[model samples]
Target: MADKAPSGRILVVDDEASLREVLTIMLQREGYDVETAADGATAQALLRESDFDLIISDIKMPKITGLELLRFVREHAPETMMIMITAFSTSEDAVEAMKLGAFDYITKPFRNDEIRLIVRNALERRALRQENQTLRQELSQRYSFANMVGKSEPMQQVYELISKVAPSKANVLVTGESGTGKELVAKAIHFNSPRRDHPFVPVNCGAIPETLLESELFGHEKGAFTGASGQKAGLFEVANSGTIFLDEIGELPASMQVKLLRVLQEREFRRVGGTKDLPVDVRLIAATNKDLATETKEGRFREDLYYRLNVIHIPLPPLRERSEDIPLLINHFYQSHAGHDVKISDAALRLLLDYPWPGNIRELHNVLERCLVLGSAESIGVDCLPPQVRDAAAGTLLHDLPEDGLDLDAYLAAIERELLLKALERSNNVRTRAAELLKMSFRSIRYRLAKFGLDVDE
Candidate 1:
């Protein structure tokens, strides 16, 4: 099954001594490590003695029937697969064998290739099940709440909010800049909720074409449109009894917004061209990078729809606002992506902390991956960083001096003015945050604003 010799341990049981030897020799020749038993009782003794990947047994045997052995295997070692051998005239018994949990049944006088192929398929299925179990365990560990990674106060608040709202049936609105892990938070909520065992479907509102978005969210009947070939279930139907995350919800067209609101209000929708309304029990989680409240005020977004979706708002702070979390996030990404053998130098870390990550966590991950791939040294130093990050750290607070010998006083004033504007922009025009960015008290910043004839209200 694994594309190599010594595939797996197999047990061959039969009443006929010649058939047992033939099966044992044939399985061994095909690269399986095989053991033989004379009957069901002996096979049970062998099962107790050791584990086997597969067991091929004759249905009619003295002491115990293969069906009885099937029950024993199901009770004791459910993972071991059982294949039944029945007489060609007893086809009904083969169907009964399947019902009793037999992996497959081979009629007597069967080809050797048929038995080999069935065994191979059974072993492959076993291997696949084991792999899926391992992968699920790993994913559960990765997305657990404790692994969210942030000691900052704002992040702690986020965790608290998530813990409180995740188990509820409320529709959640997540607001954050691009690459701020809005979808990750949505997943955390869904995976930690009661409907975790069900599906979690994610759709990007901005990515899909507006013309198809309505049908994409709601099912379409056969011949619904010019190119409609057959009936198709939409994402809402697909996410029944689970969660559906709409990312970049702000980009949803006004027409679709009305439909989405109707679904949220009525808990049901009909197919694009069908008369029957389908009810869904999906938990809605919407995310956006835009200010929906402002959009509502500006008439760009519907006020009622905004209120409906914003039942519980979770706002994520930008990386600049939570700079303290930078080191932890960097270490997390490094440990996750790069091998533990490599280390980031103190100088490099400092530069990374100082750099403005406009692209947020996603950008930081890319930068670290680039450094690890390009650098040969064990330690990642400032030299390993890209020009944008390295040069940003090296740039002075003031602009470069010109060769024309400009006036010192005017040059200093211009530098101060530009830095103030930049700080204001970075802080979303919040006076207090701008003051903090420039390392000035709020009162001092106000006095400077007054001197520049700038309106504080603006």
Candidate 2:
């Protein structure tokens, strides 16, 4: 087979012409684009002109030294990898070069295999760093505030809270119904916090069995229990210096709740079957759908732990309550999941908005995905929606009338209040826009608002 194309570019700098020629030929044969410079000064000139993945320089050189070049690379092009070459007697200088940020060092009498291995390792490390940086940027963009996707008053309040709390060390408790994107909010907080560069560990408190829950949180020593062949670090350890998201936190049993509270209070934990208590510095972000305060009152959850985790509470609004954001969410989900140019008709959108989404945003995402997959390639009409959603718009005005009959005036007033409140919410509490939505004159809207005791100055 033909020699493969060069995978990385390398610059070779040495005082000896023979060593430079040999290094260049060897690295070239190994499929690297090799450039040669007789001294550190020449190498510096070359570096100023173009980029190289790795630089190999001898410790002793004229005009400038290898250490000087290493310092220059560290200051200007820190991402570029450097390897120092030195005589066996001057190996101490190689150590100094390593301290100055050289990737590694090879002695003058180094073997060909040694040179090749070091070069390959340096290039691989550089590639890994680049990949990690790219991934971090992508994650930062993915979880940014722009991705939250809502303009409703409640959601705007949530956005503001997230921004204010993200910089603090206080634990946050995100409460919302299931499928309300609780975990997404957790991720948003983590990625936006100072701990963004560190790990963001998420564990579902309800998914793991009670038997292994402790070990899973606090790790285990070798032979701690059955199948414990080796020592293990826990999620708390993994999340040290970062944030740990405990989803479905209400599902934590009473025993574990006490232990978790201790961790929160003391900032330390002992591994299962271990004698020593290890300190941790992780920020906790807990989420649950259940009424945790009620759980505390019922004695199902610990009171102290509830208060500890509820230092910064973020209550997410359900989809039905934020119906004004439905159209934006629909477009967001469609652009995310639909790969084709598919459109949704106004009738289909109307039914979607009318349906009470008990499962919230997750349900809407799944429904949109289903529509994109099963509905027509061009557009989605009312017939394309699920039967339940379609039928929501067709439901009877009243399921059954009581035999005694209700007060007509009271019923009509309640209806009016509900529509007025909905219109106000949809218009972000702007009375004039709300009046326009209800198709009522601004003066009439003001009178009704006063009569219902719902008046608020603009």
Candidate 2 accuracy as TM-score: 0.78
Clashing pairs in 2: none
Question: What tens digits encode model 1's per-residue C-alpha lDDT throughout 9-79?
Answer: 99988999999988888888888989998889999999999999999999999889888899999999999
State the C-alpha lDDT per candidate: 0.84, 0.86
| True-structure RMSD, every candidate | 12.1, 12.0
Model 1: C-alpha RMSD to truth?
A: 12.1
lDDT of 2 at 13: 89
Candidate 1 collision pairs: none
Residue-pair clashes per candidate: 0, 0
By TM-score, the best candidate is 2
Q: Which runs of model 1 end up more than 4 angstroms from their true locations? A: 1-6, 38-50, 61-64, 88-93, 151-153, 156-170, 190-199, 222-232, 293-313, 391-458
**Runs with alpha carbons beyond 4 Å of true place in candidate 2:** 1-6, 15-22, 109-113, 221-232, 338-342, 376-378, 396-458
